[model samples]
Target: MEAEIRFGDFVREVSLRQTHISFNELAAYPKLDNKIVPINRQNEKLKVSLKDIYRILGPYTTVRFVDQVKAVIPLAIYLMFFQIFILRQGIADAALICGGLLSVMVGLMLFMEGLKLGLMPFGETIGNTLPVKSPLVVVLGISFLLGVGVTFAEPAIGALKAAGQIVSVEKAPYLYAMLNEYSGALVLMVGAGVGLAAILGTLRFVYDWSLKPLIYLSLIPVLLLTGYVGIFDPELAKIIGVAWDCGAVTTGPVTVPLVLSLGIGVASVVGRGDSSLSGFG
Candidate 1:
């Protein structure tokens, strides 16, 4: 107790010797909350019936369906009119054509709605949760799996495969083979590429890395491979356009946005400087 009193007195004597004006209180933090409140979450919940759901959703669904029809039918009609009037071509398989058009409209409406309601929300939620909830390895693994799965599920990839029939086997045997015989492997490789990209991209956001250097590094190998293929390997070279084009299509309607959401989530955590701003890139 004597030593404590002596130390306190000595500290006061030293303060008296100092001339600089200063405050020792901690700076205010806006984020910190001190007041506490309790409430029942169950009481906040609202109950509704099937009739109420139908009433609320019916107009929304109808308007969406009509919007798709308006957007699709006009373009379709213009094409049909051009074919019939200018070319003097008769419509073949009218019933099939109508059915196909109807299917297209419905498919587009469902896809747009599903993307808005399902995939985007899922991606955002997963992106936000993954970094906090899982380790780096696990997050990367999921990105890989997601890339692979989305590639398979991509409407464009399937259409690309079916469109493979138009490629002349005589002119591009390897291209045909890649699209038909080795199609599964092609998709697997593409998925793997996308997955690897996702991993790198995630790391880029987390560590505040630059896209420019990475792009330059990635471009060098790709350009070299493409050039080598164009010069030395004729058969394999046939797929050069398709190969590069497929990369674009693989990024497609689904993959890029989903990847961006995840990256944004990660960036929001550890990202600094321009990383957060470019997270969606």
Candidate 2:
């Protein structure tokens, strides 16, 4: 026989059998106290003592450190082998290089940890919260500003600028001039491009726009400009490497996740159903 059961607003159908009956048969029945106990246990776990916290965290910390070492060690070994064995060259500032390598490893470890613990959560929170609290214009505006800000602050920009020091003034005077005299303007230009990209990316999510058309439209102007520079501006052609690098580097670790989060947040609120292109920005 089948029996219908109703409790509060919920209803379910159950079969009653004559063959056997057991406590396990009623296991699916809802228990008010059972539900509350798990929640309370979760709350208790959150309120861990320092000793308990260390015990829980100790293995994870060691694993993270080991993973970082694995990433960095191979390159270090290769460089050492090439310098000492293959090239037969004496290492200069052995102590300094060693120190620098150690520092880089430590910095990378800290940076990874910071991204996981800090930047990702912060970006996700801002992204998820901003759309609900603000208008569309406000959301786009914030995304644009964030793009510009992060692009300007990107470490790769500084590296590109430093690379300008090696350019021979006689061969590429304009390139040298742009990198050295007008570097601030160059960074601003790249920042503007990134900001525009961020705005468009956000809009794509809002409208469920296909990435294909956007990609084609963007590439047309870029290809035209590249061809024009290649044909007419020989000097500018030389610094095209730096220009491309600037564009490439603008979408670094800091900018990508933050912008993606913001895009996802806005998309979740405005769009009706999840699209294949959601959170792509």
Q: Could you tell me every candidate's TM-score relative to the true structure?
A: 0.69, 0.72
Per-model tally of clashing residue pairs: 0, 0
Q: lDDT of each structure?
A: 0.76, 0.73
Which candidate leads in lDDT?
A: 1
- Model 1, 1-281: lDDT tens digits are 12123476465445432232222212222243356445333333344557556566655666667778999999989999999999999999999999999998888888888886688667767877888889988988887888788888887898888878888889888888889989899888988888888888777776667888889999899999999989998888888998897898887878876777667666666546553455534
Alpha-carbon deviation at 204 in model 1, angstroms: 1.1
lDDT (tens digit, per residue) of candidate 2 on 1-281? 33222363132112211233344443343344744653333222224457555565655565566667898889988999999999999889989988998888878877888876687667656666887898889978887888888887788888888988987899889888988999999989988888899889777777778889998998899889988998898877887778778878877877776667666556656764573236644
Residue pairs that clash (backbone atoms under 3 angstroms), model 1:
none
- Once all C-alphas are superposed, what RMSD does model 1 give against the true structure? 19.1
Full-model lDDT, candidate 1: 0.76
Give the top-scoring candidate (TM-score). Answer: 2
